[model samples]
Target chain A: MEILVAAILTIITAATPLLFAALGELVTEKSGVLNLGVEGMMVMGAIVGFAAVHYSGSATVAIFASMLAGASMAAIFGVLVLVFHASQVPTGLALTIFGIGLSALVGQSMIGVAYDGIPQLHIPVISDIPVIGEIFFSQDGLVYLSIFMVFAVMWFMNKTRAGLILRAVGDSHDAAHAMGYSVLKIRFLAVLFGGAMAGVGGAYLSLAYSPLWVEQMTAGRGWIALALVVFASWKVRRVLLGAYLFGGISILQLHAQALGIAVPSQVMSMLPYLATILVLVIISRDRSKIKLNAPASLGKPFHASR
Target chain B: MLPRLIKRQSPSKAMVYLSPILALLLTLLASIVLFLIMGVSPSGALHAFFVEPISSIYGLTELMVKATPLILIGVALSLGFRAGVWNIGAEGQLILGGLFGGATALFFYEKTGFYIIPLILIMGALGGIIWAGIVAFLKTRFNANEILTSLMLSYVAALLLNLLIHGPLKDPDGFNFPESRLFSDSALLPILYDGTRLHLGAVIALFFVGIGWILLSRTLLGYQIKVMGDAPAAGEHAGFSHSKIIWTTLLISGGAAGLAGAIEVSGPIGQLLPNISPGYGFAAIIVAYVGRLHPLGVLFAALLLALSYLGGETAQMKLNLPVAVTGVFQGLLLFFLLACDVLIQYKIRTSKKSESTIAPAVKSSIKSTSEVK
Candidate 1:
């Protein structure tokens, strides 16, 4: 029972970052922009968050710093793709490349810095409960925030007037423009929000997950989060489910070794990535389903013309 | 008045060739600012980073050595990009090629067969093809996104290489190092220039440039690829097979990347290590774009990008700068390049008060040209 609780905690730690990033990307794609720089933004957040915590000794500052770092990266993407009309695919690729390099350069001095993981929530009355309390209530602040954001995003996308405008822009920017909506403004805001969320996800990794500074520590989780967005078919609830599923798969390699499984550790490490490809293939095989859910102008550049 | 973009009636033909040069100059200017912030004299750092690396004959040859793999991979990626096949997993395919070629070299370890070198090259290409073939199969068979699958496979390939080097292919004769034994003389690429590490692979890469140019500019398949990228509906209407193009482009890229990997191990590396090619696969994507996706253009772009690698090393030694600066510079170059490409399709103009009309978009016949003056 104790071991199971421990495994669940690890899974939560693994899933929170994916959840944060995918939710952000979900919102971005809904605004007619496909930003593939989540990985880049996440890594930037990780370094900045770690550095902030190292210098200031405050997790709150670290988290905010990480978000700003991510947003700044996204702002660069926003200028190039939104204003300059650069191709989305290559521009996103450049963002990832630049983010990784900038993070490495900035984090060079912060190597070997370490911090104890962040404080977990302990509600006075509920904290004493056995399995349920420990599993659900005792997660770090980010985990709770991740769950909260999932529902928040759901409500925002389905209930809000602004959300409809964002969706309208995504489905057909020309029609959105015809309706007197600033398609670019809505998208730029969505992209910034996505960047901020990705930043928080990065902060969760450096501040709470490993609680250490290492270059490239996100370790392809950003890419996995990207697949989760697809696997969810652009639905908020499904994204929550997919993040946990992928998180569980990613942690299986660790548990397999603990359980004395005979598989090579390297082979086991490949599971999450392989699972991602498998999941993508399955979800993507339903071409019409993907088409129905995917934003019609998802990767197309928008040029508002008279 | 806010600056606004006016759509060109047709893309500027001059910008097609000129944008890369503009991007390069902008990158150099950015580098000056970056260096100034780092507390180094901008001119000294720029000289150390760019000119000092190619000052000697050996340095120039090393530039070619670095550029060879880049040229090979860049040319193939350019073709794929033209065909709308984004195979970003060339790095993984390259690693697989290295593993396959290294295995063949190991198979002929201590043996001197004349055909071993050619056999190693073929196996390397086969390794890359098989790796990329999975992506092709998935995309064509299941309609999977090639970008995500290929990128995922790269991580897998790296882990696979790690596993083999640590276990089955570990150098038995040496201390338990996580690397394979050095290849025999027959398996190594033949030297082109004595007293320098220049090898036959450079010539092979140049040969592919000619081949890629001919295939892209002079073939029916090339025409089909262009149509598919520019207008898939039109290509389908014209009876071209999308699946066939995907297969052709992916295989060519994978094969080229794999061959480059094999050449690296045979030519300069001489043995398998835990890490090989040092991000050559990712950097090739930049080369393909900066070269304007033209074969002859890619050749020059490859050389310039290759100089970044050389300059990074020189700066590290001379100016006490971190090697990560190279990656930063490379990314900045790509960013600037993409930004400049906007000039190809639009003319930037200052928005005049008379040109501030926004409500006329609803009328289909309202032309913006009347407000331009």
Candidate 2:
């Protein structure tokens, strides 16, 4: 029972960053922009957040700083893709490359600096319950925020009029433009929001999940989060499901050793990536489904008739 | 007034060539500001970053050595990018190639033969193909997204390289080091330059560039690739098989990346280690773009980017700057390249009246293209 709870906590810790990134990207894609720089943005956020905490000794400052760092990175991407009408795919790739490098340069001194992990949330009465309270209520503030975001995003994407407009822009930017909605404005904001979310996700890594700075430490989690968005088929609920599922798979490397599994650690580490490919293959095999759900203008450059 | 983009009657053919040059200039300008912000003297930093590295004859040869893999990979990636098949896993493919080629060298373990080097090179490419083949199969058969699959496989490939280095490939004579034994001279690539580290891979890279140029400019497959990228439906209607293009481009890229990996181990490093490349695969994407996705362009771009690698090392030693600055420069260059590419499609005008005059002409052209589609 103790082991299960411990594993569950590990899963939550692992899942939070992916959740934050994928959720942000989901909204961005819903608004008809494909920002492949999630990894870059997240890494930038990780360093900036780590540095913010190191200097300020405050989690709030760290989180906000990371968001600004990520949003700034996204703004570069936004200008290139939205304003200059550059190809979204390569521009996003460039953004990722730029973000990773900038983050490394910024975090040069912060390497090896450690911090006490972010404090967990506590409520007076609900926290006293056994396994349920421990599992549900004992997570850090960001974890709760992630859960709230899942619902908030679901509500925003589904029930809101703005969400409908965002979807319409994604489905047909020309139609949305004809309707007098600003496609670039919506996409640019969506991209910035995505960057901020990716930033918070990075903050979760440095501030909560290992609480230290490392170059390229986000590793391929940014890429995995990207795959998760595709696996979710742009649905918010599925994004939560996919993030946790990937998170669980990611923790398998740790648990495998504890369970005395004979596999090499390197091989164990390959599972999440390999599983990403497998899940992508499974989810993407249904072409009609993807075509039905994917935003019509997802990655296409929007050239407004001025 | 904010300058408005006036759509060109047609894409500027000259701007296609000019954009990369403009981008390079802009990157240099940005680097000056970056160095200033970092509290380093911009002139000294730029000198150390670019000019100092290639000042000597040996440094020039070393630049070629670094560029060989980039040229090989960049050429292949350019081809793939033209076809809209994003194979971003060249890093994994390169690693697998090294592993395969290195394993072959290990298998022979001191055998002397003229054929050994060629065999090792073939095995290297085969290794890359086998890795990228997984991506191709998943993409073609399962309808999986190539971008994510290829990238995911790269991580898997890296771990696979680590696992091998720690286990089966570990040198028996060395003290538990996570690396393979030094390859025999017979397994190594022949040196091209008499006094420097320049190897046969540089020549091979040049040879492939020529072939890539010829294939791209002079073949039906090239035309098919262009049509497929520009309009997939049109390509299909023209009876070009989409799957075939995907397979051809991927295999070509995978093979090229693998060959580069093999050459690295055989030519300069002469042994296998956990990290054989400094993100050469990823960097080649920038090379392909900045080179304008043309074979001849990729060759020059590869050399320029290769200088960045050397400059990073020099800057680390001289300016006390972090080596991450190289990556920052590469990324910035690509960003500037993409931004500059805007000139190819549109003309910028500051005059407010120009928008009204140009809008109708551009709208009609846009409508015609949509109608054709």
Candidate 3:
């Protein structure tokens, strides 16, 4: 029972970052933009968050700083893809490449540096219960925030007028334009939100999860988040479930390594990635399911014509 | 008074070729600023980066040695990109090729045979084909996105490389190093230059570029690839199988990437290390885009990018700049190029009046292209 609780806790920690990133990307894609720079944004957030925490000695300051850093990175992507009419696929890749270089250069001194993990929310009386209390009441505020975002995003997408407008823009930019919607403006904001979310997800890695700075620390979680959005078929609720599923696979490998299994560590490391490929194959096998929910203008560049 | 982007009725042919040069110039300007910001003398740093790397014949040979894998991978990726197949697993395929190529070398450990080099090269390409084959199969059979599958497979490939080196191919005489035993003389690529690392692989890469150019510009297969990319429905109307194009391009690109990997290990490094690649596969994507997805353009882009690798090393040695600058430069170049591509389809104008006239013309052109299907 103790082992089970511990494993579940680790899975929550692992899944929270993906959830944040995928949710942000989900909003962006729903607005008809595909920002592949999530990995880049996440790594930048991780490094900047680590640096801000080290210097300011405040987790709140660090979180905001990381969000700003991520937003700035997304802004670069937006200007190119949205304003300049660049190809989304290559532009997103460029953003990632630039982010990686910039992050590594900036965090040169902070490599291998460690800090205290983010403080958990300690709710009085609620913390005294069994496994449920430890899992639900004791997690860091950001974990709860990640979960809260799922509900918030779901509510916003289905219940709000703005959400419908965003979806309409994604469905057909020309039709949406005829209806008086600004596709570029909507997509630009969505991209920024996605960037900020990816940044916070990255921050969770550096400030809360491992509480240290390392180059490429996000280590393909950004890419996994990208896959998660696709595997979820752009559904907010499915993004949450997919994040936990991937998180579970990741922690399972860690546990296997700790158990002194006969398998090599590298072999164990292949589990999450292989599982990603496997899950992608399974999810994509149903063409109708993907086509049903996928944003029509997901990757197409919108050229506004008066 | 506001600048409205006026759509071009047809894409500017001049911009298609000219934008890369414009991007390269912009990157230079950006790099100069970057170096100045780093507090290094811009001229000295630039010279150290661009001129010093190939000032000597020996340096020129090393340039080709470095450009070998890039050109090979770039040309293959160009083929796939043109055909609308995003095979992002070239890095993984390269690693797998090295593993199999190195395995062949180790199998003939201490035996010298004239057939060894060709055998290793063939096996290396076959390894890449098999790895990329998984991506192709999943894409065809399961309708999976090759982008995600291939990328995920890359991480799996990296882990597999570590597993192979640490356990299955660990050098016996070496003090527990996670690497394979050195290849025999016959297993190694024949040297093409004296006092340099230039080998048979460099020649092969150049040859592949020529072959790629001819195949792309003058063949029925090339026409099918172009059709498949621009209009898939037209490809179907023309009775060309969509799955066939995917498998063919993937196998070709995967095969080429594998050849480059085997060559890197056999030519320069001379043995399989725990990690043989320094992200050559990913860098080749930059090369493909910079080259405008043309085989000949890839040749030039490969040389320039290879020079950046040399420049980064020189910068670290002389200017005390971080080697990460190479990646930054490549990223910036791609960004600038993408931004410049806007000029190909649109022009900035001060009047909304011109946009009114051009917008419908551009829209009609777009419609007409689709009408070809």
Find the candidate with the highest DockQ and give its number.
2
Q: Could you give candidate 2's per-residue lDDT for residues B1-373 as a string of tens digits?
A: 7788878999999999999999999999999999999999999999999999999999999999999999999999998999999999999999999999999998888899888999999999999999889889999999999999999999999999999999999999889999999998898888877989999999999999999999998999999999999899999998999999999999999999999999999989999999999999999999999898999999999999999999999999998999999999999999999999999999998876674656677879988999999
Q: Residues B27-92, candidate 1, lDDT per residue (tens digit)?
A: 999999989888999999999999999999999999999999999999999989998999989999
Task: Report each candidate's C-alpha RMSD, comma-separated, in the order given.
Answer: 2.8, 4.4, 5.0
Which candidate leads the pack in lDDT?
Answer: 2
| Model 1 spans with C-alpha error above 4 angstroms | B352-373
| Native contacts present in each candidate (fraction) | 0.78, 0.88, 0.80
* Worst ten in a row by lDDT for model 2 chain B: B351-360
- List candidate 3 segments past 4 Å from native: A257-260, B352-373
Give, for candidate 3 chain B, the lowest lDDT window spanning 10 residues. Answer: B351-360
Ranking of models by lDDT:
2, 1, 3
lDDT of 1 by residue, A7-74 (tens): 78878888999999999999999898999889999999999999998889888888899989989999
| Candidate 1 lDDT (Cα, 0 to 1) | 0.91
lDDT (CA) per prediction: 0.91, 0.93, 0.90
Displacement of residue A158 (Cα, Å) in model 1 is 0.6
Task: Report the C-alpha displacement of residue B109, candidate 1, in angstroms.
Answer: 0.4
Instruction: Give the per-residue lDDT of model 3 (tens digit) for A1-306.
Output: 887888899899999999999999999999989998899999999999999999999999999999999999999999999889998887888888888888988898898777988899888889868898999899998999999999999998999999998888887888999888888898888899999999999999998888998878888888889999999999999999999998898776778756566777787788888888888899999999998989988899888666
TM-score of chain B of each: 0.95, 0.95, 0.93
